[model samples]
Target: MSINDHRLVQCNEKDEETLLIFKKGINDSYNGKISTWSTKKDCCAWEGVSCDNITGRVTELDLKQHFLEGEMNMSILKLEFLSYLDLSFNEFDVIRIPSIQDNITHTSNLLYLDLSFNSYVSSLSLAWLSAHSSLKYLNLSGIDLHKETNLLQAVNTLPSLLELHLSECNLNNFITNPFMEYLNLSSLLTLDLSKNNFSSQLPNQFFNQTKDLTYLDLSWNNIHGSIPHSWKNMKYLDYINLWSNKLSGEALVHLSGWKQLRIMNLGENEFSGTIPINMSQILKVVILRANQFEGNIPTQIFNLSYLFHLDLADNKLSGSIPKSVYNLTQMIKFTMNDRTMAVVELFTKGQEYEVQQIETNRQTIDLSANYLSGEVPSELFHLVQLQTLNLSRNNLIGTIPKIIGGMKNLESLDLSNNKLCGEIPQSMSLLNFLEYLNISYNNFNGKIPTGTQLQSFNASSYIGNPKLCGAPLENCNIKEQNPKTPTTSMKNEDGDSIRESLYLGMGVGFAAGFWGICGSLFLIRKWRHAYFRFVDGVGDKLNVTLMVKLNRFH
Candidate 1:
């Protein structure tokens, strides 16, 4: 032990000695935070240290996101009374996880341990965790665990564990039998195995033991095959995320009985077939984007009163958007990407980014790049909470809803690449929050709306609409024509008016060209003299030609 360790151990009280050792370890490790830890002050009041009321012993040490660096010395293991330890979100890149296998058995009372976001941790470091029989919550997210082959086996040793998060751990394979054993533990409720390289399909009996599972995330893994019907056994499940996988076959039917399910995300998969009409009524979110599901959306889906998020984009689903969707006042997110399923993104600070979930009440609807036809239903505007709307790359026709302004919260709108005709809705000017607007490649005529928000959009928003004109585009009508000339007005009242406008535009163009040359000559003395000389030569030649013709005739 060093001089500092000796001083820490010199505390008169046993509890004080334990805390002093812990404090010394923290101070010696890094300096980003925990400056409040000093022997002059009560250890109980030190930052991130919590003491038991009756025993006056430190029970918890939470230094999460403190930017702490350097090696984690074993001095912390001296806290025999410590029950919780969180050193998450710190810069421990230079420190390998201390081999605690020899010492953890002495500190078996620890119930919670979170070392998440410490990138230097390795797979072997986790073996010591199994020694703590009392451990309930373990989060090792963002750790390098590629070499740990018996992850499930190690976790199974902690029967008291309730929530295990190993996300972003570089986990490649798992022992299915051990995982099943871990799942069988009645205490386990949440498990996150996301962002791994698990390429194998899930065992058919994987969920057989997950009776108490409430939250399960297997997203961003290389797992393949159809979803097992056995998952229906987990009646207590509330959240299931299998996003960005190779899951195929018609798996929605197996989930129909998940009455307790709240959020179900099977997006970015290979599942095909129509969405089940008889899904769980209690579902709050349903994301099935980027699949091959075809046919009309089931009307029963709109009846899900509790459903808020429905992402069926990037699929082959056909038919018009159901108007009954207006009933979902709880709707916060809805998407159907017009491009490929994977290209949907959110814009923030003028930057494009993807979101795993929506945390706000901003309503969104995207039905772009589909075969749906017909005019956009006016009832859609009835969703007063509506925010973003996209109906681009479809076969829909007819003018936009005149009362779209009713959606007071509208922000982004994309109506590009369709056969929509007629003037844009003037009520669109009422969209105060509108930030992005794209109505290009449509048959729309007349002037683009001139709202501050509307005019802020780039000219690309109105491109391909030849007849549409305004700022962001050419002016609706240029008034530079000569007053005496019969010019055409670009008014759409009648066919005759359109013809006259065309003729008038041509005449104005001709007069402007003629005067442009004449004015240039008059403005410059040299050019004026050159112009006169050329004109006189031409006149003399013309007169000589006329005289010659007359003489020949005589």
Candidate 2:
């Protein structure tokens, strides 16, 4: 055989035997995944295997989520040239986690290892991990690490580690050694210790050495107390989530130093005091809901040009919504192309929804369940791209603005449980995309506006407003006044009788006067003759006076 043929033949012998051994350990049901792993073909051509082009040695094995059921065979580490190995998300019945001490020489070339989500691996001892000094990425998430005592210290030995995920590992021992103040993994960029039983104050200096960390999630833990001032050194942080913890105090003042921060979630905590005023301007998501924050929503928040999701719900905040909310130019026009911005829990459509991927046009402003008062700002309607607007459970008053229809993208709206009144604006019916609406328990009056979208809601949406009527409610009716008894009808008849009596009395007085003058003269003949003789004598006296004057003038 020629030299090239001899080299190719030599590369396939040992590694191929090791791979066939790894395959035999798994149940026969998953044979299809490695069906091509036969002695006839070179091992480098097998499925889920990659070999270095020149050396013809297997370098990567990726069988993630293949549902291969079997006990882990530690002999796979015998792939001396392997650099990457992922056997995650499989039904491994038992895992004999490797202690690098037993096979140090075989694992020196390994760089990436992911054995995450193998729940059957009940116990872990990371002391063995210190042997893999060249390891960079390690994910043991969803594995039971309660029995592991040296998790932090062993992980710290990995100087080249860039990302570590131990979430849902039931890790309760936060600091195994009180003297170990800071982690030694200075090259780490991402760390997720969430969904663990970390019931202690945030270690003051635990993160001091990881100044380059850009993402940190300690959410879903019992971690209490204020954020340590030492954390301000992590200026490169881009996202931090401490949600569903007992963390408290007004120490958010330290957040202003994180100029690179973009997303912050402290929801469901005991955090009190006003929201920090000097928040980073480039922040895209701010979720401080269900806390003890009391005070006006700082007007400075509206100045954040890139803010798209602002949730201050279920706080004690008081005061009118700032009219400056219209200044959210990004929410009005800008499209957030990054779909993985942040996972948010929002109260919209009268319920809480855990949103995993915020769509490009999904802008939300949730200020519900506060002591806020004043008319809903008309200027707020300028956010035409907004999808969820929840201003419910407040003291808001006045009519819904006609411009509300301009927010055409609204999918969930709640103006319920307020003092808002007047006809639900006809413009509101123009919101064709509206899916969930609640205007109940308000002073609103007039027919609920007509539209398939508006009328599609249940009558409960229009309840508590006695005067609000239309489809989805009782029709408007004009009620007439009724007389209680005949007395009221008789009063009308008595008015007519008084008018007839007054006319009769006036006729009698005129007839009596006529009889007293002419009738008496006719009846009494002697008095009549005296009246006529007196009349004739006056007439003759006037005629004689006129003749005497005429004769004198002539």
Per-prediction TM-score: 0.77, 0.79
Colliding residue pairs in candidate 1: 313-336, 487-504, 488-501, 488-504
RMSD of each: 12.6, 14.6
RMSD of 2: 14.6
Candidate number of the best TM-score: 2
For model 1, residues 1-554, the per-residue Cα lDDT tens digits are: 11222123232366566556544444334553466666786666666777666666667888888777665554465577888899888766543344535364464678888888876645445565566778899898898877776666777788888888888988776624445644455677888888887898888666666777688889888889887777868888878888888989988877767788877878788999878778888876677867778888777776776665566766787777676645564552344322211212343322345765544354556666667777777766776666667777888888887888776678778888989999888888888888878889999988777688788888988899988888888876654222223333323346687788999999999999999998899789999999899999999999999999999999
Superposed by TM-score, candidate 1 places the C-alpha of residue 55 at a distance from the truth, in angstroms, of: 2.4
lDDT of 1 at 163: 87
User: What ranges in model 1 sit over 4 Å off?
Assistant: 1-12, 19-31, 74-78, 94-107, 175-183, 331-357, 478-554
* lDDT on C-alpha atoms for all candidate structures: 0.72, 0.81
Candidate 2: residue 187 lDDT (0-100) = 88
When summed lDDT is taken over every stretch of 10 residues in candidate 1, the lowest stretch is: 1-10
* Candidate 1 global CA lDDT score: 0.72
Off by over 4 Å in 2: 1-13, 28-47, 53-55, 98-107, 334-336, 341-343, 355-360, 478-554
Model 2, 298-392: lDDT tens digits are: 88888788888888999999999888655676678866466654556766667777775665566889999999999887778888888889999
